[model samples]
Target: MLYEGFESRESFDLLTVLKAFIRLLQKSPSSRIINVYGEMNEYDSDMKSWTKLFRDYSAKFELDKLMDQFYEEFTNTNIKISSAILGNDNNIQTIVEEADRIVHLAILPFNSSPKSKTMRILYGIVGEGMGRATRSKVTLEILLKEQHHVKVVVSNRAYKFLHDNFSKRFPSCDEASEGEAAIDIIKIEGLTMQYVNNVFDEKASVLHTMQRMPDMLNKNLDAYYKNLVSWMPQAVISDFDSFAYIFAKIHGLPILSIDNQHIVQRYVIPEEARESNPIAFYTYKCFVKAKLPRCNTIAVPPILRQSILDAKPLPVEHCEYFLVYQSSKSDTSLISVLQAFGEKCIIYELGREEKVDNLKFKDFSEHGFVDDLACAKGVFDNGGLSLMNEEVSLQRPFLSVPVENQYEQVLNAW
Candidate 1:
């Protein structure tokens, strides 16, 4: 069966395995696919922000929900999509007792904060693009090619959103109202908002999405080994999220670390601007341990590297300068530094969206980092693995401001 989880790498990895499982199913006449997930609606606050962005931004362009809509119309075959939430008291022992292959997929959320000095702008894009959207189609294609009897176990919320919307779009499939066509979707019984709240709420944001990560992974891994200990289908694929990394480590599952961006952008103050004291160094180390290790370890483009380098141009050009600070918390510090250099500054804090009296501190709820970054004269934020890597690749001359403790590592890396 194919299993899919959405959250972090551990949460979303089942989707990767499901992709392979689907291919195997096509070859086997009567094989089945089973997909599973935690609660979808009960997401980390960052996840909420991202979801809102997707819904709102896409709606404005009338292009949101295109992927699910497109997939339904493209395929015609027997498939069933079902879901069940895994409750608090739910026993993993009960589910995997049958001894079949189990796949898991999880999608984790990254918070929108410049405090994460190691996180680059590219990191966000890659995390959201592949970790969320691409996996859906990749898994679906795998199943169709494999022709396995597909069973998809998902959270009630995910199923409601994905399945219902799918059927509504493609009503002519073999089993339109929900018969098996292309792939089967089954919901796990106990996953609820309460459960997810408890799972991802350790921190105010979802970057702590890995809080319940260890336990959740151990539970799922144990169940998989107990039931299909020997057969161990093809491989377990996971992203760079720690849960995925841990799963691959503990179960000896071959890890497939998928990601697009490489570097995490930390700060983007113009050359004439002054630098402020960033966050602590230990925080930077924690990110590497908790976040970077989980990814497939991809590099960002080269352009960003050049952009960052260019931003800190030497020999003081004394050119008419504008200081645009994207980060809310760092603006005061940036201005202090710029004024020390005797440079003209225009500081823009991203809490509001419009131009206000010489200073711009707009609420960026309607605007995401990508939008903000595009408008930045020189971007300043955390150097996330994804952002830094992509910037380097793109050859953008951005600057990197390491957190207090992480300077050594960042310097060495740059």
Candidate 2:
């Protein structure tokens, strides 16, 4: 039995884990998959929609009233979904006690620590950028392939993303399989940075998140403690997630930190490069040190899809058009800037769903973006480590606009 936690607010982070879990399930045909989640209100609007669909489908079929009949009708299918709201401590405890292993997303929780001997593995990720999530995906694939049971906990948009992908990847499973595992998805509140006109607004973001902390802590802590006590995990594998780092320390579990963020902390900067932005670099390094816990092992995973790794980069002059990636729908400034380049060169903008004359806008996609990037003349995006890594790997001319007050992005850009 396995309890997977996907408690992230960022969709990319959740997608990373979701893809890994789906691949794991597909490879391990005999494995039983159980997914657990929290209250519907905790999720963002998109995730709420999915939950509603699940509820509506259940209600329409009257599955609650006729579970036996429904099971009989869909007996040949491999996937089965059953949802319950944990309104009290008893319900939470019951689920925790039944699961043999836990897989958690890397965001840190506010609850106090507990002792446990269960084989628990965690994959934590930063909530702000997709780089951490991208790296975590590769790591999770490796972990699941090794057959280690884990509980994943994430929050924000990531939770919804992983939930949707899992549904799509494994629509059904074998009902008669004996070695079935339960996958639980627990959603909790995570900090999301506020933005003003596509630029990071640090003060407002902090205040906004701080305002919600009281209620988030009160509700999640109660459930967190109960679950930890019942399902004592043996180890944690974090990808720059603070909660898992703290939990590992409190419980004395061996933690392996795998992410590119650590490169700032552990890498040796050259003498000349260190002089470029001493204050910003020092401050950023300090912040990372404070957030991450000391781990038994620290590894920096590469952030690239198989397509990117396999393809050859075209020369700058030969490559046509500029590739742009931005997550916000409200930011029109970047569009205005790109328009200045004129209709002579095409601007391929990812993360925007529509197309506008000279600019070809497309929605954010892992495979699609890589294909575009492979043939682009230049790349323009916010200073996200994932994209930056790809830019460097492909040797593409790049321009990055780091979000104000997000020092990590600033440092990465530097």
Candidate 3:
């Protein structure tokens, strides 16, 4: 939506940009440091006279009140300003040094540039499957492309995956700082479900949480506060992760819930996905509903990797093998069944180091996995929404054996 001082749909003035920033800060009311820059060489008079230069410029342009609001709004952001003009002082260099955000104004005047935005965001991912990490990889890359500072709070395999993928590009990603690539990660204990003989064990799951939740939460708090107090995030994005949801609630941050699990809670379940076990489904649904129950949540569609879009899935007649994925690594019965079929099969997440018969047990890699999926005749999976979305996109046929008692997967199957 275009606001005032936006000459058209795309362009905005410097005063307008400052006003917008102030308005955004006022609305969100979080810790931040912003450095509004202009054409560097334009103010070439005296290095120490920027205050006087902008004061004269402000008077000529009649931008006193808006500038005042801008200065007043960000006074608590840690840099003290004694000079009224341009809101600069002896410590003006500190603004550039410690800025959490930077805005570049067009030189010579206004309305010459677009007012685009980025944010300091705390991203939280649930640490169970590869789906959340893979989806987060795409979004995180997008965020880094737009120069948004992101600090991910995650644990388990998700942490390992992200750390390995991002370690090269952002070598100093251990802390959230203002730069070309600013990313930090805090390892926190994430939820894990219990499986008994390939079936979701609700009692064991509840018991696991009851036994581990307190220590996990304590460790999470200790890790987050100890490592990231200065990394004040303006927003939070939760991949159906309870830690992020709770952290947002505690810190009064706005949450963007990005996951397919929210479908049954926020939207409706398909009639085709009718519950096989009504009591189990109800219990699981209640748990999902309680995880991040709130009035205000930003919903987004399921995030898919670029490879999913690029894949051109071949037909069963022309393909050589079948692809199988099991979230439950304990499901050895599936291995026996696939073996009995006496066909070449590719398997994932069985933690196997070698091939068994014709079953090719491979380690997880995004490119390799997508390549296999593109050539595979069919898929056998546990009804993860991510893989299902990929299947739909690639037009691949699949058999879904959803985890028992988890309504989200059950709903995804249909």
TM-score of 2: 0.63
Largest lDDT belongs to which candidate?
A: 3
Q: What residue pairs are clashing in model 3?
A: none
Residue lDDT tens for model 3, 33-120: 3223222122333435555444443342233333444555553343221111132224556556324223221111121112335466
How does candidate 3 fare on TM-score?
A: 0.70
Candidate 3: what lDDT?
0.67
Estimate every model's Cα lDDT from 0 to 1. Answer: 0.34, 0.55, 0.67
The top-ranked prediction according to TM-score is: 3
Error of 3 at 224 (Å): 2.3
Model 2 CA deviation exceeding 4 Å by range: 1-119, 166-185, 226-228, 270-279, 296-301, 310-318, 327-332, 343-351
Candidates' TM-scores? 0.35, 0.63, 0.70
Q: Using TM-score as the measure, what is the rank order of every candidate, best first? A: 3, 2, 1
Which is the better candidate, 2 or 3, if ranked by TM-score?
Answer: 3
Candidate with better lDDT, 1 vs 3: 3
